[model samples]
Target: MSQLQVSASPHIHNGSSTPTIMRDVVIALVPAIIASGIIFGPRALLLIAVTVAACVISEYLSRKILKRSNSIRDLTAVITGILLALNLPVSLPLWMAALGGVIAIVIVKQFFGGIGQNFVNPAIAARIILLMSFASQMSDWVVPFEYSQRIDVTTTATYLSGAESSLPSLIDMFLGVRSGSLGETCGLALLLGGAYLIFRKVISPLIPTVFIGTVALLSFLLGGNPLYHVLAGGLLLGAIFMATDYTTSPVTRNGKIIFAVGCGVITVAIRFFAALPEGVSYAILLMNILVPLIENLTIPKTFGREVKQREN
Candidate 1:
């Protein structure tokens, strides 16, 4: 009746595809992007557009030059662009932002075999590169509309960088009326997006939950304000978005928890003592590099065997 067909190991097809998942991630980012526009002004839109275009172009050109199939349709480049734009200051020059996109796509993503083969998140790695290359531009913060009346300047310090007494109220930070990176400023918007991902089953809740909980719990035990730690800077954005990247994170449930906890610990240590104010980028990047190790250590046991016995 029917002929037998041969295929790869993942013969069972799921409804999900690369483009679909990337589309969902883009949808989840919309609220944060809109919130950035409201708080940071029209320039936010320009930066986003610039970076997105740059990334798409870079991906297309890289594929052509490498004689590889064009992967732009998959939208991983698009997500990387959006993430990079959100991490940058609105005041950054368009060219610098575009350059960051190129680095992300060319040096990081494609060079490492593209997509899932990369050892780190392209956007996070690009942000760190940009930060190192343009520290002054990267750290420059624009005053949000809500804070316009209080501050008579174009630029101000971020929450972690500012004096402890002058930090925005927990409410203001939560609502995203404070000054910071375009996307990371709005806690409510990020949470909304994060919840959407969790609802759609695009991402597991375990990594985000453990990552954020570890940060809060550790902060409290170390005499730091837990709420402020959770709401401030890019902690929420990183924990939910960047830290949970499937290619860069652990697969097993136990491995994911360990990866997340490691991220939290590094993040807290950096924020508390490092010269830089925010540590999400580096923390997530470092954990991404160690994901293989984490997975190896936390591999699940056979169904009928003891955990230790399975390992042996």
Candidate 2:
């Protein structure tokens, strides 16, 4: 006779390790990276390299100091770097980009017990911090390649911040021929990457589809251009990449729907009524804080537990 061993409940191996998942996300982001290069020129690539290096070095140093096993191999830090860079203006100084990476990997991520334990999305939080701290640099979006000149001040106003009539055609915005953040400008590239993630089963379509649909419906109701709203700003990037984060997003299907809708509503409200032209990042951050409450309300009850108690 052999004694039985009692252990934790996650007894099955799904074979989806953290490194593998992060790698898949990295692969999915390639199209957006290429689009950024085409739209923003070589500076975009340099910024990405600096930010990624900063994140990797920050994670290594933090873990070494904290006496924890190194986490760079997991590649969460790489994802953080990429996402942070994408959210930033291409003209931002590499040093500032590096600072944002440190804040993301060290403060927001590792200090809070690292990846899975983070309260909000690390990249989003870091980007918001950089935006608040360095408003001028963060807002300095260069004109798109098609209309750019060899000017001293390369910065120009984003289309979303100006009147609708003053903006580029929906086609230009969709094709990423206008000025905006490196990642958020290219709707077509983002959709391609997002589709790959969905096909790879790396992410579900529910949150993104519902989130975008909600935004579209709200824009229509509010007499705004639904297509423009969907194609412009950071809506697609946030909905597809940041909002669907596993640790920060809800686990239940109903919870995900509610979370997505809540993000969409807040985003539309901010865009329509507030001073900010775009609200996807803030909306996702706010919704991420409420994920726990949403999960509690939506998590399914165990089978027969309620019935057994009622019979007793």
Candidate 3:
């Protein structure tokens, strides 16, 4: 007779590996990358390259020093690098961008036991850190394509900065003609990337739908322009990508709904009442921290486990 063997949970196989899933995510992000390059020029691509190189090298060095198996091949570091870059302003200094990458990989990711064990999304955390540490550079928004033209005015303010008198048209906002972060400017590209992820089964539409719906409804109720609120900041980017991180988001359907709703509510509250112009990153980070408790409350009970009484 053949010997019996035992293994961990997840006995079933889905035939999807970490590298394959990360590859799909990278593919989905390509449209956003292209849009950012067009809107912000070649400097945008150079920033991405610098940040990615920083993240990859940091991961390699950290793993070597820690005596752990190398995980750079899994491509989580690459995704982290790209997401971090997307959240940053195009005019941000390259050294600062590289510093954010190191913080994402070495501190937030590997420090917490690497990929699956991270408490929050590394890219989001690093972006927040950079925003706090280098407020001026992080908030500096340069006019798109200004490097090519001899324009007297090169700096511009984001739509969310209470510049209603100079707001861009909805068409321009959707087509990446606005002043904002590298990736968050283009609603069209983000939606395309999000759709690809949903179609490829790389992510579920549940979190994004609930999060955006909640924000839009609240914004309408509060006498704000719902469409503008949805498109002005990082709401779409966070809802579709960062908020849906597998390790940081809830596992059960009900838990996901609760998590997303919480994120939306907090985001709207901050945007409406708080001093900050944007709230998506903080909302997602707070919700990521609560995922464990949400999962505990929402996880389904095993079959037949609650029906029997034991005798001592």
User: lDDT of all predictions, in order shown?
Assistant: 0.88, 0.88, 0.89
**Candidate 2 Cα errors over 4 Å, as ranges:** 1-12, 146-158, 306-312
Local error of candidate 2 at residue 136 (angstroms): 0.9
- Model 1: lDDT of residue 130: 94
> What is the C-alpha lDDT profile of model 3 across 1-312, one tens digit per residue?
999999998999899999999998899889999999998999899999999999999999999999999999999999999999999988889999999999999999999899899999999999999988998788877677674542222223245544567788878888878778899989999999999999989999999999999999998898877888888889889998899898999989999999999999999998888877589999999999999999999999888666667888
**Best-fitting candidate, measured by lDDT?**
3
Model 2 clashing residue pairs (backbone): none
What does the lDDT come to for candidate 2? 0.88
Q: Give the root-mean-square deviation of each candidate in angstroms.
A: 4.0, 2.8, 2.7
lDDT tens readout by residue for model 2, 1-312:
999998998888788998999999999899989999999998888899889999999999999999999889999999989989999888898899999999998999999998799989999999989988998788777877843542233333345443687778989989998878889889999999999999989999999999999999998898888888898888999999999899999989999999999999998898888876478989999999999999999999887665434564
TM-score for all models, in order of appearance: 0.90, 0.92, 0.93
Model 3 misplacement above 4 A: 1-11, 148-158, 161-164, 309-312
Count of clashing residue pairs in every prediction: 0, 0, 0
Q: Judged by TM-score, which candidate is best?
A: 3
